[model samples]
Target chain A: MKIGIIGGTGDIGKGLSLRISDKHEIILGSREAAKACEAADATVCTLRDRNCTGLCHGASNEEAVRDADIVVISLPFQHVAPTLAGINPTYLENKIVISPVNPMGKKDGYFFFDRPEEGSAALAIQKMLPASAKLVTAFNNIAAHKWTLLDEELDYTVAVCGDDAEAKKVVMQLVSEVSRLQAVDAGPLAVAGIVESITPLVLNIAKFNGLKDVGVHFG
Target chain B: MKIGIIGGTGDIGKGLSLRISDKHEIILGSREAAKACEAADATVCTLRDRNCTGLCHGASNEEAVRDADIVVISLPFQHVAPTLAGINPTYLENKIVISPVNPMGKKDGYFFFDRPEEGSAALAIQKMLPASAKLVTAFNNIAAHKWTLLDEELDYTVAVCGDDAEAKKVVMQLVSEVSRLQAVDAGPLAVAGIVESITPLVLNIAKFNGLKDVGVHFG
Candidate 1:
């Protein structure tokens, strides 16, 4: 499958490219296409160092959305609206869009979920896309630093939430393809708030416990 | 430490008695003293059958709180306020109070966190208690059915949250005494909403994925 990351220069986008480019064609997209190219090159170099061949290339954000079967909106919650607006809406129509965006704020060294009026980041992002776009929420709770560590496995549980059943299943399959990530369907998009909020919870756990790179697993 | 359970007839109360009574004196308290005694007897009987000696006794809710140093409010969200109101508030003064209570509701076979105006159950319950009482949120995400199954190991990560640092550590120590349960300090009471919301998220994962008694772990 062809996967495009909107904020491809970011940690999550670059990390995804490094992790899955061997199995899927990754289009690393950015506003500045040159930066995306740099990130894609870094991903390729990192994977090659580990005796792995990765297929990833750089593109403008619009071109990335225009050409991919699945699009990951890898930007922060605040930037998602403007980034999506800049892209052509028609390009995203009927395509599966994955959101790992979590709306959160830190206060007194503790993080809390800054939930949007629409309830969750996925719900809010759903309104910014074309009516036919399928939005699925996954990978919201992963630790940021853990993403670039290719030597370590992402042995975590990804709770996938979407209104569309087919798109949800496809996304869950994609999640399981990553390193040791088990995906569980967490019901419809309405439940995305619960999943998104977990990121802040895990962050707080890491902060208070003197732990590092905390991620969640469900059993 | 003498640990008291406010709703001693419940699954969590019975489970706590069976699991920790050997290490700590468990004062099982119920609205009906007879029911509390029956539950205590059952716990002792169950533990004795497995060659595990459990120290547990039944009492009225007031007596339990009056005699114990630590108290676990093992009641449902709706029942918490009224139950606490019925008891003398002085009994809970300077006591370490644990709340595994999660405010949630079900709609169309999906569970959601019914977050209170005070942000979380811990915060709201804090208002009901004396200023010296140390409140900590733990065991909110554990599956109730799993608690009573002595054969199964609760090898799950428990996110413990509280404003009081010393009290949080004490609770984390108690949590580690349970069957393979690892406790992570999840920051202050302000982060309790995130910890409490995981219950509904896990329930949704279990329901949509055709799994049973799903629990969370953090790594």
Candidate 2:
């Protein structure tokens, strides 16, 4: 399978790109061609460091997903809507689109988040994407650092939610490919708001306690 | 010093009870007599396991703070006002009242916290407690499991917020005794609302991943 990660140059994007590269042909997409190439090269270096046969390439967002079976949007929460608006939803035809964005606000000495009433950022994304696209909300809960550091034996879980069941299954498979990680079905897309909001909770714990990287592991 | 833990049988109460037992006279306060006693006994047992020496006793909420110099209120968000209302404000003179509470709600498939327009839960708690009482908000972000686990070095930073500078110093000393922790002054009591709301963020993260024990640490 060919997988394209739009905005694939971030900490999370790079982490997922590294893990998925071994099982599929991976591409790192960015608005800036130079950044896309840098991200792709960095991911390949990371894969080589892990002694894995993972492969990654660079392309523009459109070109990255052009021939891909799966396209993962890994941009910041604030950027999701406008980024999608710029893309031609028609090109996303029948392809699975996954979003893992959370809203967080920190002011003065307090840290909190504002959740969209439309539910989660994922649902908002799904609503905006073309009807032909299979939208799923996932990877919002997993810590990016955990992906890069922890080996395959540790039991980490990621919740995947989407209106379409078939699309969710693709995400579940992708989750399982990353060693001991499991994908839990947290219902449909409307619930994606809940999944996205959980990030701030994790962030708060990390922020208050001086923890650089923290992930939530369910009982 | 005589320390009062209102709602001491609850999760946060038990955690702090164990940590402070060695240096102070700890009193466990709960709505139920049996539960309060049970909580006191549990803390003693945990202390014994760690080979720490301290004294702990059980009492009703009102009786617990009657003669104590410091009072720690570990009640839930909704019960805070009513619980404190039952006590005599006269007994609160010159005492330090500490609060740690977070309010959360579930919408669709997501979990989020409800924030009052006035700001964080801590600010609300301070408003409810007597003005004569020194109010401080700390330990709201620390995970209960981490507080009790001796094998784990505390990896989180706790932010302390309050109006009384002297009271903040007292709470910081208590926080320091626990080891592997740092106390950061996040400003006055009015800003406490932000600090207290982080609990919902942490809870949401745990809920999404189905995690039992999750905590935050600041850099």
- TM-scores (chain A) of the candidates: 0.98, 0.90
Clash count, one per candidate: 0, 21
- In terms of TM-score, the best-performing candidate is 1
Q: Model 1 has how many clashing residue pairs?
A: 0
Tell me how far the alpha carbon of residue A181 in candidate 2 is from the true structure, in angstroms, after superposition: 6.2
Worst 10 residues of 1 chain A by lDDT: A202-211
TM per candidate:
0.97, 0.69
DockQ of all predictions against the true structure, Cα-based: 0.87, 0.09
Cα shift from native, residue B92, model 2 (Å): 4.4
Error of 1 at A76 (Å): 1.0
